[model samples]
Target chain A: MTTPTSRTRLSPQARRAQLLELGARLFATRSVEEISIDVLAEEAGVSRGLLYHYFGSKQDFRLAVIRHAVEHLVEQTAPPAEGEPLERLLTSLGVYVDYVLDNLTLYRSLVRAAAGGTDELRALHDEGRFALTDRIFREDAQGEILTDTPQARLVVRGWSAMAEEMVLTWADDPSVMTRDELLSVLALSLPALVDLT
Target chain B: MTTPTSRTRLSPQARRAQLLELGARLFATRSVEEISIDVLAEEAGVSRGLLYHYFGSKQDFRLAVIRHAVEHLVEQTAPPAEGEPLERLLTSLGVYVDYVLDNLTLYRSLVRAAAGGTDELRALHDEGRFALTDRIFREDAQGEILTDTPQARLVVRGWSAMAEEMVLTWADDPSVMTRDELLSVLALSLPALVDLT
Candidate 1:
C-alpha cells in the first residue's frame, strides 16, 4: 500500500519490511501502550495516514512485528538433515540459542505479546511453536521413538514450552551454560524423553 | 507506612493484601502504562501519598502484586504427601491447572510481567518457579527416582519451563485437554526426561 510519490518511491515489500524493522525496535524499548501509529509514522519517515494505510492500526502493526520476529526465529531453526535425529535436534537447539542471543529484545517483546492473552498474538505464538513441535514429532516417529497414544504430541508440546522458557532464562544468565553444551545435552537427553528403548 | 488515622482503621497485613488485590484487578484490565499511581490509589480507596508510602513507587507496587500472585498460587499447590513421586507430581500439576483456570486474567498478567524483563519481576518469576522445581527434585530424590547430575538440573529446568508455557497455552484453549488427563500423562512421561529410573 505504498503511495508511489515522486519524491519517495519504494517497492511495497521493501516498505513493509522497513516498517516492521523500525516498529520492532520501538516495541523492544517500550510497552505497546507507549507505541502509536503517529510515532511510528514519524520514525519511519512516512505520514500518519500512510502508516495506517500500510498497517491499519497500532495493534495490527504490533501483530505484524510479532509475525516477523517469529518467522525470523523459524528460519534460523530450520530442521537439520543427514544426521541422527538427536544430532539434528541438537543443531536446531543451537540455532535457537543463536537466534535468541542475536535478537534478545525482540524475542522478549514477542514473549510478552504471546503471554499477554491477545487473541492475535496468541495465535501467532501457537502457530510457530506448533509447527516446530510437528517437525520434532515427525522426526521422532521416523526414529521409531514415538508411541501411538498421542504421548508424542504432548512431549513435543512440553519440549517447545521448555525451549521457549529456557531461552528466556539463558538471556538472563548466559554464564549458566555455553550454548553448544546446553544444546548438546538437550540433544542427548531428548531421546530418553521419547521411547528410545 | 499508613498515617495515624489510616493505621487506627486497618491492620497492616489486611491493608497490604487489599491494595495488592485491587492492584491486580486494575493491572489485569488496563495497560500498565495507563495505570497511574493516583488512579490506583483512588481505585484502592486510599490516598495517593499513602499508596506511595506503602509501595515506595509504581514499580514496587507492581512487584508486590506479582509476589502476591505467586504466593497465592503456591498456597493452592501444596505438595501431596503419602504418594509416589510421580503421583505427587501429577497432583501438583492438577493444582496448578485448577489455579490457572480459576485465575486466568491474573495469571496472564503475571506471565506478562515475567516476560517484560524488568529485573524485579524477573526475579520474582524465577524464585517462584525454582521453588517448585526444587521441591519436585527433593521428592524425586527421596523416592530414589532422580539421578544426581547436571542432567537432573536441566530436566527440572526444562519441566519448569514447559509447565509455565503449557499453562499459558491451555489458558487460551480450555478444550485442548482435561487438567487431570494432562497431568497424568505428564507424570508417566516425566521420568524419561529426568532419568528418574
Candidate 2:
C-alpha cells in the first residue's frame, strides 16, 4: 500500500484534467493503441473503474486526451494581437515550429493517430486545423499582408500545409537544416505563396 | 440480359485490366467502401465469381485501383527533361493542376481513401508522392535552379504539399482563381520558397 503522492486528492474535474494531461504526455512516448485503460489507470494511480466512469470507454478516453492536447496546442500558438502583422505572424510561426519540434514525438504520434483515420479522431484533427487557420485570419489581419476573403483564406490554408510539411520533415531530422534556416524559410513561405511581393 | 460486347474476346489479363480501369472510373463517383463485387460484375457484364477470381478480395481490388490511378498521375505530371528548368516546372505544374481539376471527383475520392489510411493504400499514396518529388529533382536539375541537396529536396516536397492543397481547394471551387492565375501562383510559389532570388 503506497500513497498516491502525485495524484493526491482533487475534485473530480481536476482529476480528470490531470489524467488527460498525463495521457497526452504518455501518448508522446506510448502510442494510443498501446496505452489502454489499464495502463492509463495504473499510470495515474487511479482505478480502472474510475477511468471508465470518467471517459466511458477506451475510444472516448483517446478522443478526450487528443482533444485536450489539440486545445492546448491551438491556445499555445495563438498570434499576439498587438504586433505588426508580419512580426506577429513570424512570432506565432516561431512558437509553432518550436512547439512541434520540442514535442516531436507527440506531434508525430498525433499525426499517425489521425492518419489511422478513426472517424472521431480525424474529425477532431480537422477541427483543430480549421481553428488554427481561423485564428491566423482573425489575429493577423492588422495589415495588408493578410486579407479576410475566401481566396486569401485559401492561400493561407495552403501555406499552412506547406509549413507543416517543412516543419515536420525538419523536425524529423534537424540535420537537414538549422533551426534558424527552417524558421526563415517558413516565415518567407506564406508571403511568397500569397505573392505579396 | 445484355450482350457482353465490352467483355467479349479478351485474355484474362486484359479482362482484369479492364475491370481495374472500370473500378478506378467508378471510384471517381463512388467511395471504395461503397462499391461491391456484385455491382462491379453487373457493370462489367461479368459474373461476381470472375471478379473475385481476379481480385481475391475487396481490399486487394481497392489497392490495385488506387495504385493504377496514382501511377497514371505520376506519369501525367512528369517534367520534360529537355527544357529550361523554370519552363519545365511551370509546364509540369500546369499539367498537374489541370489533371487534378479535370479529375476533381477521382482526385477527391483518392485523397479520402488515402486519408482513410488503410496500410497499403497509405503506403501507395506516399510512394506516389515521393515518386513525383523525385521526378522533379531528376528532371529539373538540368539548370542551376534546383540543387540536389536534402534541404532542396525538402523544400520541393513541401512545395508539393502546398501546390496540392491549393489545387484541391481551387478545384473544389474554381471560382477561387482563374486557371491561369492558379498556375501562375503555383509556379511562382516553388521558386519563392526555394529562395531562388
Best by TM-score: 2
- Write down the TM-score of every candidate: 0.74, 0.83
lDDT of each residue in B1-197, candidate 2, tens digit only: 33373548888888878888888878888766676777677777777888889999988888888898999998998887676877887788888888987888898778767855566877887788899878767776553566678888889878887778788878878887788878777777766777732
lDDT of 1 at B174: 52
Candidate 1 per-residue lDDT over residues A14-60, each given as its tens digit: 88887787888887887766778877776666788878888897788
DockQ, per-model, please?
Answer: 0.30, 0.46
List candidate 1 segments past 4 Å from native: A1-9, A25-53, A80-88, A137-151, A171-180, A185-197, B1-10, B18-60, B80-91, B137-151, B168-181, B188-191
For candidate 2, list the clashing residue pairs, or say none: none
Candidate 1: clashing pairs of residues: none
Instruction: Output the lDDT of residue A11, model 1.
Output: 92
Q: Tens digit of lDDT per residue, candidate 2, span A1-197?
A: 22373558888898889889888888898866787788887777778899999999998998899899999888898888786776777788888998998888898778767745477887887788889878766766554566677667778878877888788887878898887788778776766666632
Top DockQ model: 2
